[model samples]
Target: MLEIRTLYDGTGALPAPSLTKILREAYDGELFFSDSSSRPLIVGNFVQTLDGIVSLKIPGKSGGADISGRNEEDAFIMGMLRAYADAVMFGEDTFRNAPGHVWTAGCVHPTFEKEFHAFRKHVGKDSLHPLNVVVSGRGHVDLDEPLFRHEEIRSLVLTTEQGAARLHQRYGATLPAMVHALPGDAALDPSNMVALLHAEYGVKLLLHEGGPTLFSAFLRQSLLDELFLTMAPQIVGRSRTGERPAFSGPLELSPEQAIWGTLLSVKQAQSGHLFLRYRV
Candidate 1:
């Protein structure tokens, strides 16, 4: 929609345009932009170095060379995706490690409450707000986190029934009103979860921000519809040693299906980083 053109070398890029213009073109009249049957349009958003390093130091620490000048670009891409999605999905660990601040007018608020009201209004669901879904198998979340105070934004904690019960018993009063108990281990079933969001919550598009384990689960279940990866020009040689990539080990998918990704767009941000979008 943004006048995309494919380069001869097998790459497509979206020309630089104003933010409002880009949104108008991308969404147009489509209330939803995902496959309805798929329900949740899982967009795997992650940042990695040109050499395939997702994080430079440990999972949450910030040290080492910031390769390829990609951090700002990655953040911009994420902000754009957040602006487009109806809901955002993240692993519980991401919350604990790097709890995100609510985005407001192209900026992120360090605390949640100040921007909470405006964020709900932006999504056109001020009554309940766009769902902030967290997948926590063990139900280990800090009840006193700033996210809980924002009543305007409804937070949905997806866990096993047992886990849900534990969360209730521990922080029932502090927890959000919509604590859904999943079918068996309380862990969310991707297919079932997507169905619930569509059938019950009226969410048409979902953006998944991963922390590897959850990413692996979605891929293993074949629930991902698209992947938005930002290949930063940096590398972290140590990341591969301890934990494997999201799709590592014995996962099965035909070569065509497994490697099926169509280039959508590539743009160089003001910070000199590349943003890539692909349909998986």
Candidate 2:
């Protein structure tokens, strides 16, 4: 087992439980800052290389795993965050790339299934597996994917007016999920999307594991409350002149316009990778 060393912990004054114990079986651990259990507290999580390159593929695979070195510690931490979330929000392209993937504690970190469920029960989640949410502006998702077709899963397609129409015309009759169209004006608005997730789906904590475009939108809209970042050990050098960084899309915050954050905690894995949590 990899040792987890805490270099800092501004979020908690008390000594944190062992990383394994905390990752597997801690529910008294505060996961969100919101008072309401049915409202959304959006948190974004990602792992990026030291070179500021999130993916080596200028047109690479969509899942973070492909670019994140497939570190076991990162997966475990992501599973813990997923265990806390009421729903897992993904960009449409991300959902499409990981064809059979499900956003669940068990799916991401299966070794501690019993412990994860125990923690979920302690937190009072209605279901063990989180609801799957796809956020899309253009709504170009392929609804026929196996994820939506699975009977055991509950999915929400949050898309623009045009995107919703595209979905309804092609797969409305067959898609067994909630297809909600964001108000025409609020199509790309991340805050409005959070409001809808809370009001319609009763999501208290929305965990976003992304494709960069949607993650950047959350940052732009100031919808994110926290960021869990795993700084990977390798340097995947950026080659393209206009290559995509960790968070893609139109985001160029000058030093003054930059988002300020409080460093909540830092955990250093045995392999020298850093697990950092920030309250933005």
Candidate 3:
């Protein structure tokens, strides 16, 4: 059993939880989000080191597991969030980096698979797993990946019109997932994507597990609602090569336009890793 100590919580007025007693004891805290019928509530989850390096950018070890050192509590929290989400969205790079990853509550933390499923059922989620959303502006996703091969998991791909043509030519109608062609060139508008998800899929809570650039786009558009950051107790300095990336990339926010977030809750694992929830 992972022990997560709550340092502070300011989310009392958010929403009341109807979680089962088993989940309440396992989580040892309450988490709720504001309702939005017009659009899905966007929440981001990321883990960075003390030096603010999110990815090592190495060939084989560029995922969050290396940053969090495969912490059990962090994985549990990720699974917990997945349980509450209607869909889990990430960039093409994130999907590529993790070869066989599935965006599901049980896939992240297998030990608590039953608890996560129970939580989802309590919340009235009809799907066995949250929808896996891959946002690729250029349609650069590999169709042979496990996520696409898995017949049980519902997947969606959002890309540009040209990208849709490319994917259609490459994979044709044999592609297992739904390929949506949005009106854009290279970059997709985050707001439009959210609106499409809300209108078509009825996604109330969308989890953004980003790969830096995608997160920055959402932040710049002010479409992101909340951020759940895990501060790993390690420092990996940025090299002169500049391959290592921080939380957000490419888009630099000036002092006048900086987005500050309100702290909602703080939790610390026994391994000194801090879990921070913020209302952005």
Judging by lDDT against the true structure, name the best candidate. Answer: 3
- Cα lDDT tens digits for candidate 1, 1-280: 1222222222223343223433434322111233455476677677666666554435545211143342543554455566556677777766676554432214332223223344435546434345677778777766566566675556777778787888889976766546777786645677777788777887776888776667666777877767776666554564535443432223456777565678765655444456566777
lDDT of 2 by residue, 131-207 (tens): 98988878788777777777767888888888888888887677666888877653567877888888877888889
Per-structure clash totals for the candidates? 6, 0, 0
What RMSD does each model have against the real structure? 6.0, 3.2, 1.2
Comparison by lDDT, 1 against 3, better one: 3
Superior candidate under TM-score, 1 versus 3 = 3
What's the TM-score of each model vs. the native? 0.74, 0.88, 0.97
Candidate 2 colliding pairs: none
Best by TM-score: 3
**lDDT at 54, model 1:** 53
* lDDT tens readout by residue for model 3, 1-280: 7888899988886455756676666667777777887799999999999999899999889999999999988998899899999999999998999999999989989998898888888889998789999999999889889998887789999999998898999988787679999989999999889999999998999999998989889989988899999999999999899889887877798999999999999999999999999999
Task: Quantify all predictions' global Cα lDDT against the true fold.
Answer: 0.57, 0.75, 0.90
C-alpha lDDT (0 to 100) for residue 261 of candidate 2: 85
Determine which window of 10 residues in candidate 2 has minimal summed lDDT. 24-33
Q: Give me candidate 1's TM-score against the actual structure.
A: 0.74
Q: What local lDDT does model 3 show for residue 15?
A: 51
